[model samples]
Target: MKNYWTISRKFEQNMNRLQKPKKETFKKRLQNYLIKFKTKSPQITEKYKYFLAGFIEGEGSFYVGLKKNSTSKYGLKVDPAFSVTQNKTGVVHLIAFMVLFQTGRIDFKSGSENTYVFKIENRQSLVEKVIPFYKSYVLPLTCSTKKQIFNNWVNVINKLDQGVHKTSEGLAYEILPLVFASRTKGKREKSLQDYQKLVLLGVRQ
Candidate 1:
């Protein structure tokens, strides 16, 4: 025998050449990988993900504040915050949310008998982490009102990022009428006409 092993190797190569492996598309490859990995140890549990989304849909708020500030550049300050208010009995849930998200603070609602609010006021954290997470996971599951509010909030943030909030009076004028419009049970600012008057006074001063 010349070499049985060499002959067997050549035969296997010829067979593989006739029956080549199928090329998978990138989408399919990614799907397969996600399916394999999702079950192992997902970053967040399905229970927590949907629960948070639903809770926000029911009780959360996205607020973009544009108030007259004499000390700030352009005589205006932008305060963008996210909050979810719940009864005192649900403090544990709020705490759980804080632990899971690693952002926001739990506090008693002022002038409230049995209410607490979980609020996140850090601009950097909201833009970089919290907002992005909700946009991807929580937003889709929310109602149209919540979605619209979030979209407006994001618009304010984008304008702020471009320095439009500081320099462009037109931008602030355009956005102020939209902020806090959906707030139901909390401090609702005065009418847009009042705001316009205030802004005009600030510009004159």
Candidate 2:
């Protein structure tokens, strides 16, 4: 009877060992996961896109640059640009803005205080990519002031495409006035009244 009981106990122990799960190493678990996992590029979601647009409505600037260039037909060149400025605390939004557009460059500006700016300066990118993306996703929801400025800026760009900014008179009478007038109040010396004064004064070095 003692021998029979001992043999039964040994058999039960063997059965428990066989039923227990095996311990796996971290590397083995990761390897198993990789077998089923696939990697792809990161994508911008629609919700983030709308958030960026609203953010821009508050902090962005659409600028049209008119600078003296004697070699050009107008003796001035039109440099149309889009930019958003923010403090260091707002750097995340700036980064997201860059990612959404996937085209501009980030820069730091130092003045009375330091700030960061994400700027799009390339004409091709502005007209083809930046402008269209905003037109479709952002512009429709922009506020009145921003909408007015944006509309004027786009018109100037379109006119530039048609070669309207190629002559000195054209730049003085058409482009400069439109650009300066579109900016927020108190930005320039004054409004369209100072357009000629600004042009004749030449750009400050």
Candidate 3:
């Protein structure tokens, strides 16, 4: 069955490869490529899949770290502080967002103050998302450093609900940001590499 939600799932699988391989003999970082790129789930992808190919080909604005993507288009930043969980690849240069897709929360108006903790309703980023390149490839990748950043994300989200104003830009009926995907540089260079490998695999399949 063709799942309506083709976006995030592709991301998860892609992110898996970017994760530190359990066995030291692991090679081919393709899977990790796709998953890491999953963070930037823009509305265009949600409404239309035209960008899917280019996205897989590493043609958009995603990087590693807290810096903003040169290709950062609006609308992705739907919520005041909500970030999509682009977990597998690790830190991009920018830090626009990094939250998992969290839907079905108790109703509340925007601009209110409260701490919200939305559980992983659909997808979420894991360890590989935060592993550094040197650590990922050279040394034994661990989650100790990643956990701190992960904790920061949790803290931000929790704090948002705890009194931070969830304000929007005027009366615009922006769809509430239920999903969080972080934007960053590509896996290989400034784009995700795992995407192409998966596409090839998909073709082979």
Candidate 4:
């Protein structure tokens, strides 16, 4: 009887082990969830898309930066970026943005513990994914202020795409004016006159 009971217990343990589900890694689980989410109805997906656009209209930014870089033939580099910021408590939405856009990255905002930012700075991603997505979805829903900013930013990006910024004349006359127009007055680090002076200096060098 003792031997019989021990054998039965061992058999049950093996059965339990065999029946237990395999544990999925986090990446696998996330991929599965995304697959399921994508399989949702088109109406549902469209709603989500519009929701993201509205969220961006409220919280997103379109910006172009002029940073002095001596390594370039031009005195300044044109840095265009699109970003949305949210607190850590809202990180799930930020992740949704990354998944939807198929580009950009989410990171902890500098100097803040509970803040995060989703940003795209890659020129290709900006020109391809970000810009198209905005024009199709976000642009239609944007307010006047944001609309102007987006248009100005797009003009800068188009010039960069044309390789027009390679010449000092292009940087000074064509690109710099657009950059100045894109920025909010009084927010720039240097005056437009200061930037033109730097461009002239670069040509002299």
Candidate 5:
């Protein structure tokens, strides 16, 4: 009877040990899965570059946003951005974009769950990395509407980079028109005339 009791106790101890959970075991497994498919380094090859460009062609956007700013020389700011959106299932592709571009960030898309966006809004990054990459790999493969929008976006970026948006005349005659033209016709919140009026007011001030 004593021997049987001792053997039963040992069996219980072994069972408890096996039942205990390992710390971060699931997390580590997930990391390993992601690493398996993602580029481990920023020095990706030309094939991956073209793959990313094609991905962008279907899922990417080049946007120019206008916002009213109180302290600006023209009472307006031109916000230009490049972005690609994907659901959580495809987040590994977005991670590859981060690795390849060496700039931009991934964020949860506003107003939705399980959606992610890889965005580059920094002007320097746009000029140095995003713009050049698109011009080389993306532009040649874009559809007509996307191609036109991209060209307009590039013109806007170039103008802002050159300080051409500082004067009211430049804001009205040059920058604002491009901003207006870049959008789909019915999607504009304010008309070009309204923006021109604001520029005129800025000039009067």
Candidate 6:
């Protein structure tokens, strides 16, 4: 009877292990999540498409009151108490996360895809860095290997660890590209340069 109990215990343990996500299941889920929200709000999906498509890589539900105000040039007051989940889950949300990081706005109603400002002009550079990394590292991961999905989760956690978590003002921040106003200050600035600066700031987290 003791030997029988030991065999049953081993069987239950193996069953439990099988119940968790396997390598193939994880890959399938990741693909589905990436595809489902490519154009939807909570824009992390779109942002990561660029990351997943090329590079293979790379918040918050806190109610801390944002001391909202317009810096003189931007001439606009920001909203207060933005919400984020990426920080809590430490899970990267693609496009919406970028917009949230920039403007401190989590709600889809506040976002403007057409008007959203970004300074990721170095897209090519990022792509250059990411392509090789994905090819060398992430592309090798798959279901045939033991602990493959587990290893990939660890890699993701490590990557998110490197992301922005604070602003210059010391508020929490994200990786959304920020366009800073040219300090070169346009002389007699008859153009909308200052507004452009605010737009950058508004979009800059």
Candidates 1 and 3 compared: the better one by lDDT is: 1
Best by lDDT: 5
Candidate 6 residues 86-185, lDDT tens each?
3212234434334423322222323443232111212232234332433454455523332243233223223334432223331122211121111122
Worst 10 residues of 1 by lDDT: 33-42
List, residue by residue over 38-132, the lDDT tens digit for candidate 5.
63433467998898898899889888888888778778878999899999888877877776666666778999888999888888989988988
Q: How much is the lDDT of residue 94 in candidate 2? A: 67
Ranking by TM-score: 5, 4, 2, 1, 6, 3
Candidate 5 residues lying further than 4 Å off, grouped into runs, are: 1-43, 203-205
Task: Give RMSD to native, each candidate.
Answer: 17.6, 22.8, 22.6, 14.7, 15.6, 18.8
Q: How accurate locally, in lDDT, is each candidate?
A: 0.69, 0.71, 0.28, 0.79, 0.81, 0.34
Ranking by lDDT: 5, 4, 2, 1, 6, 3
TM-score, per-candidate, Cα-based: 0.67, 0.68, 0.19, 0.74, 0.75, 0.22
Write the residue-wise lDDT of candidate 4 on 1-205 in tens digits: 9999999999999999999998765456445544643532122277788887877887887788888887878658889998999887766676677777666766788999888888889888898888888899987767787788789999999999999899888888888888878876675567877888888677433
Which 10-residue window of candidate 6 scores lowest in summed lDDT?
174-183
Q: What TM-score does model 5 achieve against the real structure?
A: 0.75
Model 5, position 115, has a per-residue lDDT of: 92
Worst 10 residues of 2 by lDDT: 33-42
As for candidate 1, its clashing pairs are: none
Name the weakest run of 10 consecutive residues (lDDT summed) in model 4.
Answer: 35-44
Per-residue lDDT tens digits for candidate 2, residues 1-205, read 9999999999999999999999865345434433422322234688878777776777788988766566654345678899988886666676666556666755686572458887888888889878887888888887787888998898888888888765646667877778876677774544564545545555433
Supply the TM-score for candidate 3.
0.19
